[model samples]
Target: MTERESPFIDRTGKSLERPQDQWPPYVIPKEAIDLEIERLADLPAPNNGRRESFIAHPRAKEPGLGLAPGIRVSLSVLKPGERTKSFRHTATEVNFCIQGGGYTEVGGKRIDFKQYDVWNHPSYHVYSHVNDTDELQVRLCYSDAALLEMMGIYIADEDPPSVKEEERDYADEKNRTDPRAKNPFGTFQLTDDGAWLMPYETLINPETVESKAHHWPWEQVKEHLDKLSALGKDYVGRRLYLLYNPMTGRTNGTTPNFFATMTCRPEGIVDRPHRHTSAAMNYYFSGRGQSTVEGEIVEWKAGDLMLSAPGWAIHNHAAKEGTVYELTIQDQPLNIAMESLLWQEDLKLPAAILGSEAGFGTNR
Candidate 1:
């Protein structure tokens, strides 16, 4: 075999203790984003009718260029009366409309969304965006495309078929009659310690849970969020609500890979320093704030986007004035699913693997 084909490294006795390369916190000011939106708006419309830009971190590499290690954020804009071509991808997404209003057609369903609305796109579902109104539409889309790209499985189809054929019910006729579908030797316990042996027939046919798109309008969410301010100064927990999708189950995410939370930080409210294995990015829309990330203070105002917390980096935020409304996207669900979500709710306490252990609680 050629030397290029035999790509193997001998590490029989090499030292395993190597420092982790954690990315530093970064921020994209409102001005930079506004300029980019203007620039995109000025450009001639592309053939696909989609004008988008990826927000890459300074330390990010080609395989997974994203603002966070596993979370990819992209800015998309559409002119009035314009619409994107039909497209589908393996990576699920959380779409947030930051400016104007539009509607998205996904999986034969139409979702009409306004400014500050949040919605999820299910995996492998063909979708397209339309701006039927007179105003320009701007959106921030967060996805696991970066992670999928790193894994060499980020498949996207720009020319998906305009009409998807009706799905056949496998369990209705053929599966019920097929002898191979029924396993004579079913799964059974093999050990007292909970070990079990599953037949190949059973292994290939796992339970299916239908995943659907859900929308949370900002006005509806805001009404509920504003009530949390009454929790007063004595409340210890953050005032936020996870835009949960039931399909994620115990993972607590908007998509399988990420959780999007809308936070309401009352004036002068400060959070206690905490750390987690999942990286976090925040988009502040309504007020100014400062985040102390890894001992470095980073100030931000309304319309700014920030990489508030790198994985496992201690961080905290304080509202400077008025009620601060921000949308935080974190790769917590992926970590939790992997049983690697180490969360430290308090600096003085020990960190615990969140999904696998007893998690921390706050005084209500």
Candidate 2:
């Protein structure tokens, strides 16, 4: 790097540029693993009323595999019959259920969650999780929690919510900008028993009633998953975009801070390189595969995770000729919202990438 690009500088007017290995836009194939659960189980509420953070603390240790300016991913697990302490939050926590089944209590509302379900805990809301089942429950959480804390705008209240569900003093639109309250997709409402109130919507006025929590049920998602895993299919992209909230009908399910989608690379297919500014953190649900991140092969299997460094990493995917299913989280919506999303595809690979060997493809 040149003088301006050097990271280290002193009064000598010279700088030391770190090695390229330190540079990001690379992959961290599952920086976190099941080991986190064992560690957390030894502790107590949501955090065991404690916390075991994977991300580094400024005063303590070196940084882990992560991105800059605010994107972060972490883990939280609760043993069966364990519950987290209730609190009003200041962090944006979006969770993808890694395993186990339970419900989360948010603002006096109940959200039933199961394996592979995606949900968000809104900022400035009262929330906690309850594991009622007989197995270990893990949550793959993504958020800008550390970012807000680092910026000095962080807000967290240990106090519980004083207002009951029936007594919440909310305006017609509690907070329009909050994705939870916005509810652009579905018409739902609050009931006395903490159940959702699903109302009908009219073309004239789409906003009728809505609920606080949103869930993408895996039961409903399984049909699509099965259809994508067909044998020798003539037409298939093997990728599913998890946008469009079924309730709200909005094209996206996530907030601007993050968006997640699922893709499947079936047996014997090799994908070409593609790049974008939005870094992708991929969680492997099932399959065996290897990714070439800028020529760095990152091999992964079921239950592992990987990252495609943001900003121009030539990444390609291939299974050991085996089936692979990937769940990816990226800040693509954020970049697009900020008008900074760029994408590129490698021109060298033939159309065989998507199993389109005939050189025939349909735009639709």
Candidate 3:
């Protein structure tokens, strides 16, 4: 009987054997891995520290679902001579030209954006988009009530107000004219001296944020983590860049609010039981591992999102050879505003820190 048909005596006479090496064949330096972690930790948030802006055409496609909460991704299509109304808004927004071309008019200035180009708009900016493309498409990423509420900056206008030209004038007067502005998002005044809002810094621009090495620079990635580490309050592990931070005008770098990080566990690696004060979510990027979230052993994989509420629990991570998901938070804003932040880095140390091992495992 063929191996497939034979229950015993070797279907096809094949035998399976476990390889001596469980991890991937690739070699990875601990220092290099630590540097990568630092890079992610040092990523900078948006600010007048850099000039950031974009002009998306009217005809754009919808941006797909993202990991952030309370955000909606969508696309728009604009035809020639089709102009959008100019309005003042306070919600953060980003857009990328997917297939078409278009121009946006802000403060009576026209900026053009084409496919693969990204644009960032800060909160409380007066702007509008128009489609002047013969055949262009656009996609945009933006947040709704969910994001606003998280930052404690939500505003509700239950009633629509009549058009006011004077209000438009005030917005137009605040328009930025400096070509050297460094922020990718539109600039906003924090003080009379000119403090630019940088809510888009963490979302690095391919054309901007120079990095000479193979990996992203430390400041370009790890600044977010550093910010969280600085906050000495109920801080726990985290996942980052889920959304834009209004205060810094950046993606997921350092926020005056929340933070996160993904952990990596090579095959056969196990992070012994440990606990912390901050609640967190683990977004598995790859590999196979089991995390004892609270008490239950949770098997994980790529794209899987796990949660860990605040306080200590018997949590451990194990994998034959793969990367583990990681996310932690101390609720920066909640602690800062309430003046109740605290942290203990050395406390409840896990036996194996993520990225401690050097090697790879199964490709998956």
Candidate 4:
């Protein structure tokens, strides 16, 4: 018989004061992305019909290679008249169209998107991308797959089967009427301090909220964002709108793991220096800008993607010319749900544990 080694490590009297090593801000220039897209377009279609490449940070390690610690960004290209095989994964995703137009079939719904459009994919929902146009279609897909991969539980199925509509309806009805699905004793308060005792049935059969795919067309969002410039130069808050998904509830996200916001910055406008525990990545689609991250200056222009804010790193952005349009994605919802979202809207003020504490507000 083989003997197993002990899994315990003795840390007696050892100091537990290890400081976190934050990753440095990185940028993928527009030229590089364009070159890659062209290269992808020239390659023969794979068996799966998915031509994709991950944008990884230099500091990232294997098993979870991502531009940020918790966020994975991938550049995917589909040639004209091409489509990908059906796929489903346990990780949720935010999909942003960068070039051309295409449609996605996800969870039995078809969402047609154009350039600069934003959409989300719910976890475990079978999806496929199709490029029915005459031009090559490109997208930037952001996901929490890095975090899941780090936890060693990232799951993906190729060509997954679709759930039959009648079977799904029948199963829902059965679960609704099953006696074992209900807890007779119910969850009751056990102490004055808010502790409660829950039965096994209740623990296993929690309320289910339908997670759906949502689309945010750029033309529609742009009209509303353009109005933010009317707020003038005195506005303290960011000129952005979050692409919200109702299923996330109080977490305020487009998906369970991340929040996607479209920001419109007028010429010469600068953002205040601030820091947050959640990392941020931005894709600029219009005009030019410069971001100061941890005292380092990084300039960007239209079609550039950057890791503007590494976790807890001080950062600020300024528009250089024209109206700058950018799409920013952050793993803020996951942090809030974990009670670890620390945000400092103003450098002069102390950081707040956002979600649990009152958040900072801006004047108009």
Error in Å for residue 254 of model 3: 3.5
Query: After best superposition, candidate 4 residue 338: deviation in angstroms?
Result: 0.3
Model 1 TM-score on a 0 to 1 scale = 0.94
Q: Please list the C-alpha lDDT of all candidates, in the order they appear.
A: 0.91, 0.63, 0.40, 0.92
C-alpha RMSD in Å of predicted model 4 compared with the true structure: 2.7
- lDDT, ranked from best to worst: 4, 1, 2, 3
- lDDT per residue as tens, model 1, 1-364: 4466567877898998867667889999999999999999999999999999999999999888999989899999999999999999999999999999999999888999999999999998999999999999999999999999999999999988654575667766687678877888789999999999998766876888898999999999998887776767666777899999999999999999999999998888888889899999999999898999988999999999999999989889899987899999999999999999999988787889998898877622
Comparing 1 and 2 by lDDT, which wins? 1
Q: What C-alpha RMSD separates each model from the true structure?
A: 2.4, 11.5, 21.7, 2.7
Cα TM-score per model: 0.94, 0.69, 0.34, 0.93
For candidate 2, the lDDT comes to 0.63
Q: Count residue pairs with overlapping backbones in model 1.
A: 0
lDDT of 4 by residue, 128-169 (tens): 999999998999999999999999999999968885532556
Per-residue lDDT of 100 in model 4: 98
| Residue 263 alpha-carbon offset, candidate 2, angstroms | 2.0
The lDDT of model 4 is 0.92
- Name the weakest run of 10 consecutive residues (lDDT summed) in model 2: 350-359
